[model samples]
Target: MSTKTPFKAIIIGGGPVGLTFAQCFSAAGLDFTLLERRETVTPEEGAGIAISPTTFRIYDQLGLLDAINKIATPIPQKHVMTKDGHRYNSYEFHLRECHGRPMAFVHRHELLTMLHSTLSDDAKSKIQTNKSIASIVSTDHGVEVTCDDGSVISGSIVIGADGVHSKTRRLMNDLSGHEEPVFETTFQGMFGNFPRAANVEEGSQMEPGHDWEVHSDKISSQCFVGRERGWFIIYRPLAPGPTRERKTYTEEDVQAFAKDLIEMDLHLTDKVKFADVFKVVNKAGMTQLQEGAVLKRSFQRIVLAGDACNKITPNVGLGYNNGVVDVVYLTNALKKLVEDAGQTEIRTETIEELFARYQEDRRALSETVDSAARRVIRTVTHSDFVKYVLDRWVNPVLGLDKVYGTKVMGPLLAKQQVLEWLGEKNYLPGKIPWVHRGLVAGEVKA
Candidate 1:
C-alpha cells in the first residue's frame, strides 16, 4: 500500500512572504509545511525596510499591528532636493489616513523576528529550516517536491514563495520549455548604525549639524530614527560599478569603499566617518518580469508568486507587500474552490481556473507598479531636459504627494480601486500587455 501524505499545501521558502503564507494557511486550518534553505530567521545584517500602508493592513490581519507599531519609526516628510541642498519639492505622508497607522522604518531582521514569533507552536513546528528544494513534479494527483536531502514530500498544491532566484521557478521553466529569464543590472549598498547627532529631528534628513551639504553625484543616503537603535544611515553609490564576479567584501574593504565615497563626494566628509560605520556591498539585480498564460500547457498545475513571477523595481517598496497580496488572492481563490467542491473532490480543472483568476488579478497590478517604479528610476537618473521639467517643475507644482499618493501609492491602500482597474482591463487569466509583449520579443536575452 502507498503511504498517504499529510499536507494540504507546501510553501517553498521561509522568508517574509513565505512566512506570511504559512500564517495564512495555518489560520485557514490547512495542514502545511514551510521549507527554508537558511539556518536562521534573522538576516545576516541590519537592513532597513519601509512598510507602506497596504503592507500594514495585511500585518493587521496577521495580528502583528501592535508589535510593529511599537517598534517601527514613522516618516513625517520626504524632501526631493538638489545637490547644493536646495529643496525642490517635498511630500508628507498623511499618517492618520494611511490605514489608521503611519509609514514605518524598522530593521528587516526585527520585523521578521516579530512575524516568526507570532506563529503558534503547532504552526511553528511545521517550518523546516536548512532544507533546500531541488525539484518539483506536477502529477495528475498532486505535486511532488524533492529536497536536497533526498527526502520527498507531496502536497495538493505548492506555492513558490521562494525569491527571485527561486529553484521552483527553474523547475517550472524547465518543464515548460520557456525561454530563460534575463538579468537587467545590479545595485551595491552599504549601511550602518550611527550615533544620533545633536541636531537631527525625530524624522528628518541626516546632517552633522543644523547646516550640512549633501553631495548629489557621488552618494545617495537616507537616515531614520528608530525606537531603540537611535539612528542609522544607508549610503549607496548612485552609479554603481559594472556587474562583476560576486565576491564577499571584508570589513576592511567596506571601510575603504566608505572612505573613498566620502572623499570623492566631499559633501558627506564631515557628516560621517569611516571608523563609525559597518558596511556590506552586495549585488542587487533585476530580471524582466513575465509569465505565461495560466491556460497554457506549461502553467497547468504550477503557479508563481512574488518576485519569482513578477519582479518589480524597489523604488516604492511594494515588492514584498505585493507578494503578500498575491498569496492573499491565491489562498482565497483556493478556499472558494474548496467550498464549491464541498461534497466532491476539487478537480484539476477547477484548480487551474482559480489560478487563472489569480494570475489575471495579480499580473495587471504588478505591471502598473513595475511601470511606475521604473519611471521613478528613469526620472531620477535622467539628466535630460524633459525629465528635468517633470522632476522639478511638474512634480512640485502638481504635488508629488498627490501624483504618487493618488496614482501609484493609493492603489495599494485601496483594494477596490485595484480590483476595479484589473477587472476593467481584463488582466486576469494572464493576458500579456501588447507593449510589454513587443518589448520582450525584441530585447536581447542574457
Candidate 2:
C-alpha cells in the first residue's frame, strides 16, 4: 500500500502526543498537517517523564526507539525512603523482566525532541510552528481551524493534542451549543529540579536506577534522575479552590514553595538533602492540575486527545502515556474510514458513527486512568493511619505496576485494528492475552 493519506488530518499542538499522531498517520498512509503554537517542535515544558513498556511499543511503531533510548534511563528499582535518609521500602523494578521492558525515565524535553525528530521529511513538512489556533468551527463534512494570525485551514478531521487549557475543546463546546465544557476538576502540585543528582552515587547514596520519594506530613515529594538532568515533583493537597482554574506563578513564589518544603524534614542523600538540591534549582512551578476527561471526546469533525480530553494527576505518570495510546486508538478509527473510502473518500452520514465509536472505545479507559491516578494521590498522601497502612502492607503488596499500569500494555495494542491489521509481533508479550481483544498498544483493547 502506498504510504499517503487520502483525507487530510489537521493536528493541533506539536507536543509529544501530537507529533506521535503525525508519525502514526504518516505510517498508516494518511496525510496530515500539524500546527503548533510554539516556535519549534521541542517545547521547554514538563519534566521527569515516565515511559512504560507500552509506550516503547508506540515508539517502535513511530520508528524512533534507538533515538529515544539514547537520552532515556531504565528505572530498575523504585526506592522509598524517610526524611531521615533511611530506606524503608525498596521494590524491584521488575517490569523489564516480567513484561520485556523497563519503565524508562527521561527529561521531558529530551523525549519531546526525539519524538519531534522521528517525523519523516514528509511529516515534517506538515508542521507549522507559531500558528496558535484561535477558534474551530465544525462544518457539514469537515472542520475549519482559525489561527490567531487570521488564517483558516479546513480539513476532514481536526484533532486537539493541546494541553488541559485546550482552545479546541472550548470551541467544540461552543459550536455544539453546550453551555458547559466537558472538563471540571483540577489538582494542585509543586515541582522543583536538581541539576546535580546525576553526580550522586546510585543505590548507595541517593536512589536506585529510577526516581525516589520521601513523604512529609502535608507534602509528598518525588525525584526522577536521568543521565544529565533530574526533576523534583511535589504534590500538595489543595485548600478547596474552585475547580478548573488557570494559575500563574512568579519565580519567587515557586522558590518560596520549594524552600518551605525543603525546610521540612525530607532526605535523599547524606551529602544532599532534597532541600539542598533545590537551592540551585533550574526550573520549578505550581499549577492547578486538571483531573477530568471532557464529557465527550468528539464533536462532529473535531476530536480531542491527550490533556485536551483527559488530564490526570501525575502521581504515576499516567497522562502522557495515555496520550500516546490515544494516537493509536484515533488512528485505528480513522484507518477504518480510510480503508472504507477506498483511501480518500468518506461518507458524511457514516462520519458520526465513526467518531462515536472512537469515543466509546476511549472514554472508559480515560475514566479508568483518571480514577487510578487520583486513587494513587489519595493512597500515598493519606492521613497518618492510612499512610502507615499503605507504607507497611498496602503499597508494598500492590507494588509499582498497578492493576491497569504496565501489566496491561501488550494486550492493549493487540486490540487496535491498525496494529492488529499490520500484525505487529514486537509488542511486549502479555501473560494473559485479550481473548477477543488485546492491548491499546496496551492501554488499548486486549
Candidate 3:
C-alpha cells in the first residue's frame, strides 16, 4: 500500500492527538513518520482527560477500547454544587444506556502511554522523538520538513498536531506571509492530581461553582474522583489583553496561585478545602487555555489537526475528543483517496480538495464545540449576570441540564464520525442508532 500511493505523511508532535493520528494512519494502511519535539512520547504530566462515547466508538474499531477500559474509570455520577459546599443538583450520566459506552476518565499520562504502547511494531518504528521541526517547505511533488538538528524528512503531506503553540502552524503562516494570531488565551488554567479525597466517592464528578464570598466571579472548578486518585482543574479568566503569546510558569507562580485558592471548599462537605488536595498533590501544572480554530487548516500539502487547528476550553472535555474525531475524518478521507488513485500519483490539487472538505467538516463541529465550551466556562464562572442566572437558577430549576443531555447532545453523539474504510462492527451500539453507519468488510458499498 505504501509503495502504491504517493501519500506518505509527516506527522508533527507526539501528544494524544499526534499519536492517535499515527494509529489511524497505520490502520488505513497509509505510511507516516511521526516526529515529536519531546524526548518521550508519553510525558508524565497533566491531571486527567475524559474519553467520551463518541471517541470510544473509534477506539473500539481501532482495537484499543479494552486497553483503555483497563486503565480508565467510567464516570457514573455527577454533582453540581455552590462554593459554600451546598450540593444543588445530582444525577447519573446514563451514557452507556444512551450511547453504548460510558465516559472514561483516566490520568493524562496513562492515556498517552496506552496509545503509544498499543501501536503496531511497524507503526512504532516510524516514530522519532527529540526531533523539533525548524521549518516546512512544500514543493510541487511533496512537503519537506527540516529539523533544528539539520535533519530533513519529506512526505506527500505535513500534518501539524504540535498543539496550541504549533511550530508547523507558524511556519505555514510564514510561507503564506500571514502574521495574524491563530488562537486567543482568555483564561489561565491550573490542573493537578492527588490521592482520592476521603468521602469523595469513586466514579463521581463534582463541579463546584464560584465562591460568592471571595472572588466568586473570578473562577470555576471541576473535580473527578477516579478509582485510585482524584483530579481537579480550576479556570480563571485573564484580564482582557493581547494574550496570544505563550507564557511559562514556575514553582513560585504555582505556589502563589494555590495560596489564593487554598481556602476554597470542594463542596463535598465543609471538611475538604482546596488546601487538603493541594498539600497532597503529586503532579500539577499551570497553562493558558487558548481558544479558537485556525483560519487556515491547510496550505499547499501541509495540513493541521488536533490542538494545532482547533482549541476549546477543557470544562466541556471536548478538546481531545474532537481531536480524535479529526483523526477519523482525515484517515477515512485520505484512505479513500489513496485507494481510488490506484497506480496514479495524487496531485496537489486533489489533496487540496480533500483538505478543503476536511476543514469544512471539522471547522463546523469545532466551532459549535468551541462556542459551547466558551459558554459553559462563562456560565460556571458567572462571568455575566445572565449566565449567572442561567447557571445558578434557570438550568437547575428548569432541569435544562437533563434536557441538554438527552436532546441536544444525544443527537450529536449519534452522528459522531467513524472510520469509513474500516467499516462498522457496531461494537458499542446502543438505543441511539448512529447516523453515519459504516459498511462492514465484504459488504456492498453504499
Whose lDDT is higher: candidate 1's or candidate 3's?
Answer: 3
| Candidate 1 structure quality by residue, lDDT tens digits, 289-365 | 22212222125567777766665554455667777778767666666555555566555566678777777766666
Q: What is the C-alpha lDDT of each candidate?
A: 0.57, 0.70, 0.80
Over 4 Å off, model 3? 1-5, 197-216, 240-242, 264-271, 423-426
> Least lDDT summed over 10 consecutive residues: which range in candidate 2?
432-441
Give per-residue lDDT, candidate 3, residue 309.
Answer: 88
Which of 2 and 3 is ahead in TM-score?
3
Please tell me which predicted candidate would have the highest lDDT against the true structure: 3
**What does the lDDT come to for candidate 3?**
0.80
lDDT of 2 at 432: 38
State, as a TM-score between 0 and 1, how close model 3 is to the true structure.
0.92
List, residue by residue over 88-166, the lDDT tens digit for candidate 2: 6776665566556778888787777887777777788889999999988776567788899999988878899988888
TM-score order of candidates, top first = 3, 2, 1
Instruction: Score candidate 1 by lDDT.
Output: 0.57
- Report the C-alpha lDDT of model 3 over 227-287, residue by residue, as the tens digit: 7777778888886743777788888888877887765544422335677667778888898
The C-alpha RMSD of each candidate to the native structure, in angstroms, is 9.8, 4.6, 3.7
Give the CA lDDT, 0 to 100, for residue 336 in model 2.
Answer: 63
